[model samples]
Target: MSGIIQLDNSDCSYIKANVSNSHNDAVAFEMKFAKDITIAQLKSKLEILTGGSASTMKVELYKGDTFVTALSNNDAKLGFYVNCDGLRLHVIDTFASFGFDSESVEKFELTNDQYEQRGDSVRNFLKQNRLGKYNDEEMQQMEAKRREHAEQMQKRAESCVLGARCQVTVAGNPTRRGTIMYNGPLEGKTGIFIGVQYDEPLGKNNGSVGGKSYFVCPPNYGGFVSPLSVEVGDFPPENFDLDDEL
Candidate 1:
């Protein structure tokens, strides 16, 4: 409603398909479906230009003198909400948006190995194919595929995060260090940290005898990442060469 956020080419520092992970309030901020020129895109370009590890990232959006910090917190009120015009798009996601009157939607959480920063790959592909902007039809197609993939991954990854009687571990240990849960043997070193006691943040003074807690997942594996349902995973580069003209 805020005019599609009017996101432009130079206004972003980085827009990652990820969970905000910060619990300044009860809600987590997720940055996904990044298009346009955003902070992530800029960070990718800087990486390509400078050729180095992504440095300390401090991104902020500006309209005039004020900087936007997603949602505002009422330290006095003790709660937080997603920012207005806040957006997160996922092909494989935890939270599903069933508009109008769909109330059966269920969100799942899991922990896995950290994924690398691929926004540059995405940006490069977009630039190569001249697909920087998203039209309605394309956006719709992407959203649909995201949901589909999310469902499938949910089947695979959810086992390690949620279950009846479960044990979760990360990095080949039974210490339960991540958000993985399993109902059966993996036959390999994967899918741990399921059914662990992940923590949440409460008022500093609101801690019970148990204490406030949250998940300590590795980077890139914390936030939700989308899966592509385009099928035919073996498409050659030539098949996608004209993506710009799409």
Candidate 2:
């Protein structure tokens, strides 16, 4: 019975599925599948809802401790075992039961509101299971990293003297060569800044960032960068020549 079934209708059959993970955490949800879908296709859909691999998931039709035949073949059609509508399919995830990999299974491309709703469910589950220790440890580590970054920024700000030759390396952007025109906080800004007058016109504004000017320069020839990203160095401009002095 591990082949396609010729059903009378082409419409998808919506059925309630009881998906249980390795830890016995169960979630009931409605799933739609074409009547002639193979066992492999049904297993794939259950994997999305339960994190169960198609190779390891066990499918069964049961009712109140009643023993029923398990769906063992991945090539069989749904209509082979699912005789009528509203049939309950219990999907057991063997991969999760052994506690080997416990990564969260979530859908991607979710909106902010959808993420917030899912986050609430996760928070409730964590609270009920007392699984907040791992999250707390991760937060502490992140806070430590923030403090380390602040200390580095303070050192860079103190070392950045006006007219100092510097190179700014913004993440994912090309390195920029410039001179430190100013080295202090701008008006209406929270953190210290390094106003760089670039050797080329690869800047956003004339020594300004976000509409606040810290120093004057030609338009599109200067920009403000974070002191943390500014590398104060003895390296002069690439075109600077000792032969000119000679």
Q: Which candidate is the best by lDDT?
A: 2
Task: Give the Cα-based TM-score of candidate 1 against the true structure.
Answer: 0.23
lDDT tens per residue, model 1, 1-246: 110122222324334332221111122222332334444444444344333222433322322123323322112110111111233321111222335344565634322222123444443354445442323454565456546644664464443333232222221122212222222222211222122322222112121112322333332222111111011122222233565785
Q: Estimate the lDDT of model 2.
A: 0.64
TM-score of each predicted structure versus truth:
0.23, 0.44
lDDT of 2 by residue, 207-226 (tens): 76657667899998887777
lDDT of each: 0.28, 0.64
TM-score (C-alpha, index-matched) for candidate 2: 0.44
Lowest lDDT block of 10, candidate 1: 223-232
**Per-residue lDDT value at 20 in model 1:** 25
lDDT score at residue 68, model 1, on the 0-100 scale: 29
Per candidate, the number of residue pairs that clash is 24, 1
Off by over 4 Å in 1: 1-56, 59-130, 133-138, 149-163, 167-194, 197-246
